[model samples]
Target: MSFVAIDFETASGYHPCSVGIVTVENGQIVDEFVTLIQPPNNSYNPHTIQVHGIHPRDTQYAKDFGEVFPEIQKRLQNQIVVAHNENFDRNVLIKSMALHGLHYEDLNIPNRWECTLKIYRSKGFKPAKLSDCCRVMNIALNHHEALSDARACAYLYLLR
Candidate 1:
């Protein structure tokens, strides 16, 4: 029942503009980490901004993925990682690492993360986006905001 639930909001392409990690132990949340990240070249897409409300200016002075990898590594290495949409979040992590010349193999996490979206789908939850599942389960959510999404993903996993 112990795991780390993570979420990432991209600035453009697979470049992470923000990240959130929630650590759970014995089924209870024990720690939470969230930070805005400077994407490659501190650039952002207008469409992504509409999704997460994070503009280039929001992370202009924030640390880049390389600068923040140590923190991400300490939490995720050798841990059970979960996400609402595992494929997307995992790709963001891997691609962001690659963008910064960091190797994904060094993290020692599984290639496939536990996915709440897929899990809920299997259990017959239709329209199982993070927000949809959260709404059905009465879990509070802030949608594309990384920390809130991660926290909601964690709660949904616990319920599952």
Candidate 2:
């Protein structure tokens, strides 16, 4: 089965202002996609930015959500898309995309999902935070950056 491990960094709790999807097909990362978006609402909280180091000014290089949707759909097409916290990430994705007139059901890609955090917790692991999971499993991390976090999640998903 193919699985695309996806991760996102929001300007805030709003839909993903940025996202990274690591496409793993045949047990390898064959492709990946990252996109930055201008949020309809300035969900950029100073506290979160301290954790993520992104601000509206820094997002000048990103496309607005509407512009990147097509590319996102194209890349994620026909794969099992999974994440550390699949529900949370998918919820953010659904809501954020909704703001731009896209709906979750419309994203027909990635027909299956495996939430690594759920599997880890089910195994009696104490924490589900990606960094914490890394610590427990001895996977080093560069926290909060979408690509690096996505990379780490992909590795952790494989370990499971």
Per-model TM-score on C-alpha atoms = 0.98, 0.89
lDDT tens digits, residue span 1-160, model 2: 4577888887777656678878777778888787677766545867768887878887766777788888778766665777888877777777777887787777675434678889889888886888889998898778887777777788888888
Worst 10 residues of 1 by lDDT: 93-102
Residue 4 in model 2: lDDT: 78
lDDT for each residue of candidate 1 in 114-141, tens digit (9 for 90 to 100): 9999999999999999989999999999
The lDDT for every candidate, in the order shown, is 0.94, 0.77
Candidate 2 clash pair list: 79-110
Write down the RMSD of candidate 1 (Cα, Å).
Answer: 0.7
Cα lDDT for residue 69, model 2?
80
